[model samples]
Structure formats: structure tokens, C-alpha cells
Target: MQKTNKIRVGTAAVLAVVLGVSSLIGFSSSANAAPVTINFWSRGAQADFIASVGAEFNKINPNIQVKVTTIPDAEFVQKLSTASQSGSAPDITSVDLILVPYFAKNGVFEDLTSYTNGLSFKSKLSPAHMALGLYNKKQYALPFTAEASVLFWNKDLFKKAGLDPNKGPKTFAEIEAAAKAITALGGDYKGFYFSGACGGCNIFTFAPLMWASGGDILTAAGQPTFTDKNVAKALSFYNRLWSKGYVAKSAKTDNGASFAAPFAAGKTGMVGAGAFFVGSLKANPEINYGVTPLPGATGGKGSFAGGDNIAILKGTKNPVEAKIFLDWALNAGQKFIATKAILPIRSDIAASDYVPQDPRYKVMADAMAYGKTPYSVAYTPLIADGQSPWVKMLQSAIFDGKIAAAQAAAQKQALAIVKKQG
Candidate 1:
């Protein structure tokens, strides 16, 4: 049986332990004349989900209310940086997971080793996400939401192309062959689709191929290794498909805007995307889809674990209220996310906890387990920046067929950027 209790002022509240899952919080309530507000800043792309989570949070914790601010993804880093430097940072923020290392390195977030260690699900949290939130052995954040880049195949299109609708490609060759067969159907039938000109999108989707094939573009210490053979193979994989005209033309020009339109409309056979893709296509039940972790050229599978990490800012005045919210996030908060059809932070969450939802969630979960993220303090300039060498490298290799030149230039540019960060 479950019990309910309203948290009171200045008293330590023990979060109810339920279903073998538990969390501990001993923070005293904020001694404020006015009701304490926990300002939670979430990126615009994630604002809707964050707003829903905020509403649920207010329901149980009557003493504290989370104020959510939606910052456009394009301006989040700049706005947050300005706020942090001027000593006006939000009580807590959900930052892009890949940028966690960058923020931690720059001392933008509070050290949460003590708090994170207390959470029971800390051990079960996504490893890729946990690793990102660490800097100098100090934990700065906890995964708020998880998004794993996995392969999405249109099952109906597969059957129409004379392929098995149930079986998705497990290797690059299989993917290519599937594309060929699908493309043979001619008019508007795309075999494989990609955001050829989008750096972030490519890294989210394409880098996993290199990872699966035992190739990595960065050393653990934030050094660039872009000239690896695995990277060449991954880029060449797209080059082969593009050269054969099996890829959609939109791919060459897509700079991340509406990249999924082709695939979601059931015209494209295979593409790489994340959980948000499922949410976007939810209204279109007309298309039968199947998902798998991105596969290597020969056989291995992997994904880019991308999404947001929740961390209390370094100078928050409402530490107690902020921590109370954080504690709730690790338990009930995760349950809330599951209800929204988003992936939970904890790997151990029961299937019953999530929406009786897409059966393909298992694929996303496996991808999360199998995935890894690049750890670098120079992440913005190296990968996420619009003008980064990564996008140019992909374009040069995939579209211009300048693999050697592209690799050399990218390596040199990457080294320069990382050196500047040092």
C-alpha cells in the first residue's frame, strides 16, 4: 500500500520507498518569507516535456513550485552563460547532455557527487549519460531524459520493396542492399535518408556507425582523432549510397530542418532518429515502423546517447528546494517521463512504468545500453557549432568525394580548437 504526505517547512522529508526503488533527501526547507520558487530552465526543444514535468512536480510538493523558462536551443548556451557569469543562474537547468562535460570543465554547474551518490538509481542510470556529467571525478549532473539515436525502418515500405517487414538491417551491407531494392521501386521511393549537411544530426546518427566498427573520433582526454579508418568507412558508407542515387536528394540540402519528413511520410525506407521522432510520428499511425540500434559495416550495433542532463546551478540560493526537486526527479520524476513515452533515466525501470507504448522502446533501451558519447570540453567548437569542421568534413567526404582532404583539414582544425580550449 502507498501513503501520501505533504512536505512541510524546515523538516527533513523521507521520500516514500516503493517497488524496490527508493531515494533519500534530508535537505531542510528554505526559510523564505515568500513561497520558494525553483527556476528550471529547459531548452525550447524540450520545453513541452519540461512544462508537463513541472506541472506534476507542483502537484505533490505544495511548498515548492518549479518555474520553467524555455530558451530556444539556438540561444540556450549563450543565455545560460550570461546568466551564470552575472550570478543569476537558474536554480536548476536541464542542459544538453553532450555539453555537460563542457559546462563541468568550465565550472558552470554545482558539484553533485554527494547528492548523486545518495540516489538509489544512480548506479542504474544510463552509463553514457552519467559519464557525460562527470568532470575531474566530480558528478555535476544527472540525466533528466535520454534520447538514443537508432535506425528507423518503414515496415510497410519494406514489404512493398519485396523485403521482410519484420527484419531490420543488422549490418551496413544489409542496409545498402535494402536501399537498392527499395530504390528499384522508382518514383519517390528513398532507400536510405540522412541530413547530409547537418553536423549535429550526423553526429547523432552517423557517428554510431564508426563507434560500432571500433573507430572513435576523440580520445578520452579530449584529443581529436578524426582521421581514423573507421570514420572513413562510415563516411564512405554514405558516399556509396549517395553516389548510387539510392539516397534522397533532400539529404544533400537538409541542414537539420525537417530531415525526418521523408522517412515519416513512408516514402523513405530507413533513417536514423531518436525517441522524439516517435513522438512526432505518433499522429501518423498509417506508417508501420520498426527500430534497431545503428549497425556497423560488418555486424556490431551502437547509438549516440543524446538528450538533457539535470543539474543544480552552482550559486543557487534555494539549494534545499532545488535538491528536493532533484530527489523527486530520480524517482517519481522518472515515472512521469515514462508516462510521456520518453525514455527514463534509469535502465532498471519496469516496462509497466512506461506507456504500454511502442514495443520498439526495447530497441531504444538496448541502444542506450550499447551507446557512448564523445567526451570533450571543446565539444561546441569541435562538433556542435554550426561552423565546426565536423560538418565540413562530412560534406567533403560524402558529397565532394574528398575523403583525404576532408580528414586532413578536419584533423588540423580540430586540433587547433582543442588547443585553444586547453
Candidate 2:
């Protein structure tokens, strides 16, 4: 119920950083310099990948040097904010899709739409992913990855539950029923498990349930739509699952452990996760699992679109060079497809090698076409706050024995926040 403090970056320092980059870019090295040292920054988690991309790019454009550095993942945004205010920001940076809205809103990015005009690559990206890096109809960034929520069930668990391992749940009702059966097996494992603390995953996995059932937290115009009966019905489904003890208690405090730990340990019957999950599964062949689509409402399927975005800083003096690099990233051939990402927001490459061919990966790519992404400005914090109420409400209603009060209280609070956002 307490308001979470806003951890926004101070504006002054960031503004200064932007100016510094601009001045540096203006300095003349040689017209065809061998290394045009450009500062590149990435958060801890993505630093390695960015470094690899830099290495590959350097091989082709040896004259253009990209110096990539890692910012602590937890503090990456704040650091960027600080750099921008301080007027010492990097020439280029990769941002989480969720943060794009905030950066775009602040006018901290170079508008690449005009530079990219005449390019029809935008049509190649899925609508869900295409929306992540867009703000006010301008393209500030290009997508670096595409991910969505997918159902992952332990084939062994399904067999034990008298369900077909090859045929996973297609509808929410079926998933609920299967979960109940898995719980009846009764042991260290549960029928299903997911993060109660994870806002992004909650939206990806659960919001679809709300939307598929004909409800949504916010409408296309960004109005609160949670008070609608459909929304309440979706919430009720979650409540019923928790109340029935199909969810593990550990899920309450767990944001990461729920899916990875349980699935890796072979304790959970089912989970909804991204395609990257396959990499983790590969590490542990001992754990047998199968990937399936996220369950639909009655029969319809949908999932949230997710990915990273790249943008040039607002004050960059080398918009031409930066735009060249952006274009190269989305250009045809191996460079575009080599990153294991979806499309480069370019259709030509979207259907090319970038689209995975494996059965599991194909499912992910196919789902992208139908996915929908939430537009949450300052998304990292908004998601945390938004999902917390629903999680707490479900906990009390299902586990703590206060169904009616919990429902009324949660609905009352969530609706208020939604209204405020509207």
C-alpha cells in the first residue's frame, strides 16, 4: 500500500553528458580514420553480447572503433541518466525495451525515423516487438531481440498426471485442471510455478489471460480497463489457482527461482517462460522438458512481446555515422542473423536466417506474429507497483483466508492506480 519512491535520474547531469558527446563527435580526426573511437555502454547482463557485436563490427569497419563498457545491470539506467545529465554519456547504448518509452519521452534519443525512411524493415517486425521501441510514432531504436512467454511443461510430469506429454494445455481451463491433477501427486513439487514478484513475467503470462478473456489493464488509449467483468474474471482465475494450492509457497517471494530452480530441479509440472529457456535446459539434459504455446482463454492464444532496443543519444554529433551503424544492424545477411535475436525490425531479415528453424524456436517465432506488448512508461517501476497489488490480493484471498475483502481491496487499489495512469 505504501508508494514506491521514484528512482528517476537527475536531469542536469544527463544533459551535460549529451552535450559532451556532441562536442567530441564534432572534432575532426582524419576523414577516413582507421579508428573513430566511439563510446558504447551496456548493462552487465548484455555487456558480453554488445562486446561481441563490437568485435564483429570492428572486423568489417576496422576504421571505426567501438569501445564497449559494462554498467552494473541494476544501476545501468540510473548511470545512463547520470551520464546524460552530466553531459558525458556514451555515443551509443543498448536499452531494455521497457525503458525506451521513458527515454523517448524525455527526448534523450536521436530520431532515426527520417534517416531510416525509404526502408521498409519496420514491416518485418511483429507488432508487439515493433511497439516496444516506438514512442509518439517515431522510431528511436531498433529491436535487438524478440522474446515472448511460452509454456514449458515437464513431459515426465505430464505423463505421470495422466496427461499427454506431447499435447500440453491449450486453454486456461485445461491448464487449471492439469495443475490440480499435478498437485494431487503431492510432494516437493507443485502443479505449476511462476514469479509472484516479477512484473514483466506477470504481464507476459497473466495479462494475456486477462486480454484473451476480453479484459485488459489499459485500453489502446491507455485508460484503465481492469474494472470490467472480464478483467475481474481473469483475476478470479488466478485466485482460484492459488487458493486450490496449485502454486508453491516459494512462488510468493521468488521472482527468478520459481521458473528456473523448479524446472531445473524437475519439481514443477509446468511453467511459462521465453525461448532462451532452451539454453538453460540444454545445460541440464537430466531434466526432460518440452516447449508449448502459452495457454489461451477459451481457445485463443496470445503472449506479451518483449526485447531490447538500441538508440543514438540525443546530443550525438555523429548522427550520420550512428545512423549508418543502425542501418547496418538491420541490413541483410549473417551480421543481422548472427545474434540469435528475432528480426532486426526489418522484414527481409525477419524471414531470413534470423527466424530460427528448430521446432522449439519456430514456435517462438510463430507466436511473435500474434504477440502483444504492454506500453508501460517507466515500465520497470510501473510493473513492480502494478503487479504487487494483484499478487498480494491473490495471496490473501487464496492462502490467508480473506477472499471477499482481498478481492474488494485489490480491485479497489489496482483500479485507482489504473485511473491515475489514465
Candidate 3:
């Protein structure tokens, strides 16, 4: 095979493919052999799933071994940035879709377009999934899983609220009325649950409500749009929920877990969650729950796209073998799909018997169409920083009944962020 660059990148930027391999002794070999050991890294609770996938890959090609490293998600960006700066990054890495633009722009990864040339990309993935790898027209990352936010409701709780378990509300007004009904009959019950503490999940899960209402945090060119009327309107909607006591006040610091607990414990009627939530629910055999698409805002559907991305790191000694690894990893038959908790990225693979037999599996596959992820270079990591102010804005307006000032403050803070990013 011809020598070329085979590094992978994250979402939104174009990746360039060039032919060349490093002369590093540990990674380059005449063949896939014991001499070659590829280093890789990832963060988040999903590390177990990734490790399982890597293990499956090794079973098929024992010669090229992959050494996996995991760091807590809270420290992921810090560790990855430090490693990248010091030239100690692994041969492969799991990059967040939002972080891809920043990492690729900073020259932290190699372009992966060439390596993906002979593989079946289109038939395997959805258009949105394919778009995650395009950074400025270059291909850097390959989509490994399809994730989306959905409305998960406790069937038992819904029935208690005098609503049909199978037929949830279809519009925002209906949702509001339902929430009021649920709250009116409250005894350790909440109509809606969302995180005022976790900006990463909140931005995706809640921002879509605004997007569906026809507003966005930023434009494609990376300018502020938080002042848009639709944004104010959406914020007002959530604010009403908070004022009506339909929301859990504990959301102030809980991020993802707090919202999950109330719903999981059967105390709350509805919570917005991702495909992974299906697995979480399955683990609890006692909770009888049903999921539906998030309600449309003014007659349109929207939600955040959530998933991990796979990429080859720069400075690797074997481009060819890495390509083989990526192609094989994307195969529909990999054991990782069933055994691991992550859902498959390929639509064709998602439809296969290996994944389709389970009833809850269908919702995981359906979420891709409803999910939308941010494309900003630095916006991703900022979500985790306490100073981001997204949660406080929601609380100020919704919980405190200060809609006008809250909207203005949120817009100011959001614009400041965009300007700082510039």
C-alpha cells in the first residue's frame, strides 16, 4: 500500500489525507505483528463499551494490539489537551463531536480521508453521521455510534396523571397542560425534570427545544443568535415550568444524574434522555417506562445528537493497519454492538438481527433523526465549565419568575461567549 497520513479528526471540519508513516519502532512493522502495539484513549462512563469493542477487534486480528486508556470525563479535555501538546497522545482517541473542531483546528490530529477511501461509508451510516467527520471538507473522524435525545416517561406516573401511557403529548401546549396536571396532584412528583447544573447535557437536551422553536445559540459562522425571539420564547416556556413547580429544584447542581434518578425512581413523569438511557432502564426491571419523541415546538421536531467519535491520532507508524482497524470496527457483525452498551452507527448494521430483536432497541436507532449537535470548536468543553452560565439563566427566568431580565442576561452572556471565542 502507498504511504500516506491517516490521522482522524472530529465533527464539522474537513480532514486531509497525505501518505506517510512515522519510523517509530514500536508501532511500525513489516506486518500486523506483536511488534506493533497501538495506544488509544477515551473518557466518560462509556469506556467499558469502547474497551469491549477494542477487545473484539483484537480477537480477529491478534497481531496488532490496542492498549486502551481511560480518564474520568471531568478531566478528559485537560488530559487530552496536555497529552496532545506534549506529543504523547495515543495512536487513536475517542473525541467528542463538539471538541473535534477545536482539536482539528489546533493541529492535534491527522487527516483520515485517504484511509476511508475503499470502505463502505454511505450504505453504513446516515447523512448526519457522515457529516460528523467533515471538518472544512476533510474527513477526520468516523462515526462509531448513533445517539439522540428523547422523551422518556414513567408509564405508571403518566397513568397517575390521568394521561395515556402510550400516547404522550404531541405539542408544547399539551406538554405544559400535562405538566400542570401532574404537578397539581404532586406528592414527590414532578411534571418535567431537567438539569440546571449540567450544561453539556442541558445544552443538547434543552437547546433543541429552542431550536425546534426556530432559534439557535450560534449561526454556522459562529456568531451569537441567543437574542433571537424564538430563543426568548423557548426560555420563557421552560421558565413557566419552573414557576409552576413542575421542575425539580435539585437540578441546580446535579447535571445528568439528578434528572435521571427522579425518573428512574418513578417519582417524576417525564425526563429528556439519550439512547443510552434505554440500556439504563433495561438494567432496572421494575420500572415500566415508555419513550416518545420530544414534543414539537410550533409543529416541528428537534433534539440533540449525542455519540462518541473515533479517530486515528497523528504520529502513528502504520497508516494501513489503522485503516484496517477502522474498517473492521465499522463492520455490522462486530460482537461489540450486542455485548457493549453503545448503539451501532451504521443504519444497515442497526437493522440486523444482532441488534433488532430487543424491543427497546428500536428507540435507540430512531433517535438519530431527531438529534442535532453543536459544531463550534471550543463550545464543547465550555459546557462543563461552571462559568458557562446556561443553567443559571434557566433558573433565574424559570424558577424565579424573572423572564425579562433573565432573557437579557442570558443573551448578554451568550454573546460574550461567542465574542470571546472569536
Each model's TM-score?
A: 0.90, 0.81, 0.86
Rank by TM-score (best first): 1, 3, 2
- Each candidate's number of clashing pairs is 0, 16, 20
Candidate number of the best TM-score: 1
The list of candidate 2 runs beyond 4 A from truth reads: 1-34, 44-48, 71-74, 332-350, 354-356, 385-422
> What local distance difference test score does each model get?
0.85, 0.67, 0.70
The model with the greatest lDDT is 1
Residue 142 in model 1: shift from native, Å? 1.1
lDDT per residue as tens, model 2, 355-417: 555556666766677777767563444455535555555456445656557656765665566
Model 1 CA deviation exceeding 4 Å by range: 1-34, 350-352
lDDT of 3 by residue, 1-422 (tens): 22232222422123211122233334665532334578777777566577777677787777777777887877777888898778787877776666677677666777977755656555566456556666788878877666777778777777877888777666778778778878777688888888777777777678878877887767776665655778777778777777778887787667566656677777777888877777777778778887766755665767777676778877767766666676776773243665555667777666664356566667656767656776776575335565665665666766676766766676687777766775
**Which prediction has more favorable TM-score, 1 or 2?**
1
